[model samples]
Target chain A: MLIDVTDAGDPRLVDYVGLRDAQLRRPEVSRFIAEGVKIIERAFAAGCTPRSLLLQPRWLPGLRELIDAWPDVPVYLASEALIEHVSGFHVHRGALGSFDRPQETGWDELLGGRRLIVCEDTVDHANLGAIIRVAAGLGWDGVLVSPGSADPLYRRAVKASMGSSLALPWRRMASDSDLQRLRDAGFTLVASTLAPGAVDLAGLEPPAKAALLLGTEGQGLSDAWSAAADRHVTIPMAAGVDSLNVATAAAILAYALRP
Target chain B: MLIDVTDAGDPRLVDYVGLRDAQLRRPEVSRFIAEGVKIIERAFAAGCTPRSLLLQPRWLPGLRELIDAWPDVPVYLASEALIEHVSGFHVHRGALGSFDRPQETGWDELLGGRRLIVCEDTVDHANLGAIIRVAAGLGWDGVLVSPGSADPLYRRAVKASMGSSLALPWRRMASDSDLQRLRDAGFTLVASTLAPGAVDLAGLEPPAKAALLLGTEGQGLSDAWSAAADRHVTIPMAAGVDSLNVATAAAILAYALRP
Candidate 1:
C-alpha cells in the first residue's frame, strides 16, 4: 500500500523533519532516513531492511518491485510538492526511505576475531561518515564509536559513507569500562597519537587482534585513554603541517594495521 | 594605502573578480587570494611575498603590524562593501589578502631526495586539498599534479589543505614526459588500483624513492597511467563498499610509506 502525505506537518513525515537531532538520541529509535534511491538501494543491498519507503508518484513504477521486495514494509507515494514540504528542503530527486534503526553492535561481537577501529570524541558527522566509508573499504572488522563521537547513522554521515554505515558493523561505548572490555577480550588497543615513545606506524608488527584508536582532530586522545593504550604510534609528518583530518588519519591508520 | 571601493565592480579590484572562472583557467594563481589570517601568514612564511594585503577597515588596526612586518608588501585597505564586491562574495570574515604568485617549483627540486605523492586525475577540490594537508602532516616531500588532477590552488582546495599547500612543494605537469622522467629517475611508481596482482597495501614495502599515484573519485585509474606504475597496490577494502576517497587513500598510502 502506497500512502500519500500532503503536508509538512503530516504525522507520518514527522520522523524525517529536522532529522539531525533524532539520530543522536538512541540508535534503536533513531531511524536513518536515506533520501536518495542510490543510498537507499545501497543500504538495502547491504542487508538493511527499510521501515517504509516514500517515493514521488513518478518513481513508483520503477521502484515498485524494490518496495514490494519488502512485502510488509509500507510504501508512501506523494506528489513532488508534498515531498518538498515534508522534507523542509527540496526533495531534489523525488524519493526517500526510512530504515528501522539497527541496534548498536555488541562490543564482544565486534571484537570477535577482527581488527577494530575506535573513534574517541570525533563528533563531526562528515568525518565520522568518511571514517565509516574507509572502514568498509579497507576491510576493518568493526568500528567502535565513543560516547563523544557523532552518530554514524546520521543522514549526512550515511550519505558521506556512501551508505557503508549499513554494511560496516558499529557499536557505541560510554566509558573506560567499555574500552577495557575490549582489552579484556584480547584485542591490542593501539592509540594513534604523537606522544613520546610512540613507534612509527609501519614499524609496529601487525598484532593478532588490534583496535586502532583515534581521537578528536583538535584535541587528540585524552591523557587517560592514551595512557591506557597498549601501544602508541605516530605518522611522521612534516614540521610545519598540523595533522591530517580525523577521518583521513583514521583511514590511514586502519589501512596500515589491516591483518 | 587602503583603497575603499564599496561597489562590487570597482576597477582596482578587477584582479580578484570571477574567482570561479579564474580557478578553472589557472587555479595555481592561489597565491593571489587566500582566506583567514593564519593561511595568509603561512603563505607569507613560506616565501610567498604579498603584492598587497587587502583588508576591511575594521581589521586594519590589528593587522597593521603584520602587514608592516612585511615591509616591502603593500597593505591595501578597503571598505567592507568594496571587499565584498572584489571577492565576488560577501567577505564572510571581513578580510582577505592578495599576494604575489609564487614561482612554480621545479619537479626535480621539489622531489629532491624526498617522498613524492602523485595524483593522476583527482578532480574534487576538497579531496585534493585534503591530500595536500595530509602530505604536509605526514612529512612527504612534495606532490605531483598529473594531467586531469584538480588545481591545488583552487579556493576550496587551498582551504581544505588548511594552507599546507603554501609550505608543500607542488608542480603541474601537462605532458607524459614528466611522468617518464620520474620513472627514469628510479622513482617507484605505485598506483592505487584494483588491478590483478596489485599487492595488498599492507603487504607492500616502503620504497626509498617512490610516487604514490591516485586516480579520480568514481573512476579509479586510467589504463595508460595504471600500466605505467612500477607496482599497483590496493587498500583491500571489505566487500560491497566503494573505493575510499582519493585524499583519504593518499593519506593512507603516505602514512604507509612514511620514512
Candidate 2:
C-alpha cells in the first residue's frame, strides 16, 4: 500500500493542491488535508479515515503501524526532497493525508441541551480554527458559521485547531433559511457588540439554551443579526481600544454562558 | 533629516537589526521597532516619542501628513529594494518606526479598578501580544507577566498586539517574591486549572479587585501557584479535546470576569 510517487502532477494528488475553497458551494466536496503525525493520528482517533497519505521515505518506519491500520487507503511514499518539491514548501512534519470532511448536523441537533457558538462572517481560517479549539476546550456543544466565513477544512485552519476542527460538531449556515431555522429552534441569540446601548457581558443572566454570536475583525455584527438576537452584550473595554479578536471574544462569551 | 542608507548593518539602524532576546534586554535600548503604520501611530498617540522613522521612498507621498506631525523624529529614506534588504524581509507595509519603550507601572496603581490579567508562564510573544490586544479591547486595567513569561516589548509581540501592547499598562514580575507582593495586596488570585474540585469558570463571580492567572501552553497551573490562588476555576471542556490556546483562554476568562 505504500507506493512511492515523484511527480507533483500525479492525478491522485490533485485534491491536495489549493484545496481550501473548492467545495464552498457543495460542502460534500470538503476534503481535509491533515499534515504532521499528531494531527493525522488525532483525525483517525476522531473516527476519520484517510482517503490517501503522502509520507517521506524516512517516516516509513514510524508510520508503518498507521499505514498497516489503514490497509485499504493508498499510502504514497516519496523521498523527503521529493515531498519538499511537490508540497512547494518545506514540510518538517514529514507526512500528509487527505480525509473526507465530516458530515453536518442540524441546529437543533447540535444545540440541544448544550452551549453553542455562532460566528458571523469570521472570514479568517486561523481565527475560525482557533475559535473551534477554544469551543472544544470550553465545553461548547457546536459551532454555526455564516456563509461569508472561510472554509474550516483549510490546512492552516486544521493545523491551527490542533485537529479539533475535524472532531468538533460544526456546520455552515447554507443560507438565510438556515439562520431562520436556528432562530425558530428556541435558541436565545446573544449578539456581541460594543455599542452604547448593549448590556455588559457579565451583567446578563445565563440563558437556558443560548448561542453566543461573534462578528468579523473590523466591522462588528450586522444590524440584521443584532435585530434578530434576544440580547446584545458588550465586553466593556478601555476608552481608546477597539474590539477583541472575534475568536477570543467568542471563547470568553461562550465560557461565560456555558450550560 | 532623511538619510538614505544602502547597508543593512548601518550603525544608525542598530536598534532595528536582527532583533533577538539579548538586544531587547539592553538597558540602553530606548527604542523598539514598530513594523506597521498603525502600530507606529498608536505608539505616538499613547505619548511615546519616536526616535526615527524608516520608510520606502514610494510611501513619501501617502504619509506626508503623519511625517509632518512628528517634527522631532528623524525620518530615514530608502528605496523599496533597499528597505526590504535592510529589514531582512519584504517591506510591503512600506513603513517602520523606532520608539522609546515606556517606564514600568506600579502594581497597585495598575490594579486600581483595572481588570488585570496576570500571565504566569506564557512565554510566547505572539500569545502575549494577542492577550494584550484583547485586554485593551475588553476594558481591562493592565497586564502583569510572571518570572518565566516572554518580554512584551519584543518585536513580534508588539506586532501581534496591533500596537495596543504599547498603549496598555504593563510590567514584569521577576520572581515568586513579586507574586507574593500581589497577594499581600487585596487582589483575588483566580488561577485557571483542569484539576478536580476546581470551581467552574462560569460559577466563579468576578471580584471587585481581582487578577486572572493563566498558565503555560502544555502544563496547566503549577502546584505552587494553584495552592497560592484564592480560588481555582476550570473552563469546562468536552471530554476528548485537549485545551485552548493560553491567550484565547486568557481572553475568554478575562472578558468573563471583567468588571
Best by TM-score: 2
Q: What is the TM-score of each candidate against the true structure?
A: 0.84, 0.85
Displacement of the residue A99 alpha carbon in candidate 2, Å: 1.2
lDDT (tens digit, per residue) of candidate 2 on B20-99: 43676443467687876777777778888788888877667766777788776678886666666666666556688888
- Tens-digit lDDT track for model 1 on A1-259? 6787766677777666664344334555657778688888887887777888778878777776787787878787788777776666676687888887777777557978568888897788789889988888878888888887888887778878888888788988877668888888898999999777899877899789998889898789999889889999987667766677888888778877776
Superposed by TM-score, candidate 2 places the C-alpha of residue A246 at a distance from the truth, in angstroms, of 0.8
Q: What is the lDDT for B197 in model 2?
A: 91
Q: Please provide, for model 1 over B3-62, each residue's C-alpha lDDT reduced to its tens digit, 9 standing for 90 to 100.
A: 555566656665667665655336545455777666677777777777776776777777
Native contact fraction, candidates in order:
0.98, 0.94
Candidate 2: residue pairs that collide: A237-B138, A237-B139, A238-B139, A252-B252
Which residue runs of candidate 2 sit more than 4 Å off their true CA positions? A3-30, A55-65, A76-82, A90-92, A106-115, B1-30, B56-66, B77-82, B90-92, B106-115, B205-209, B227-230
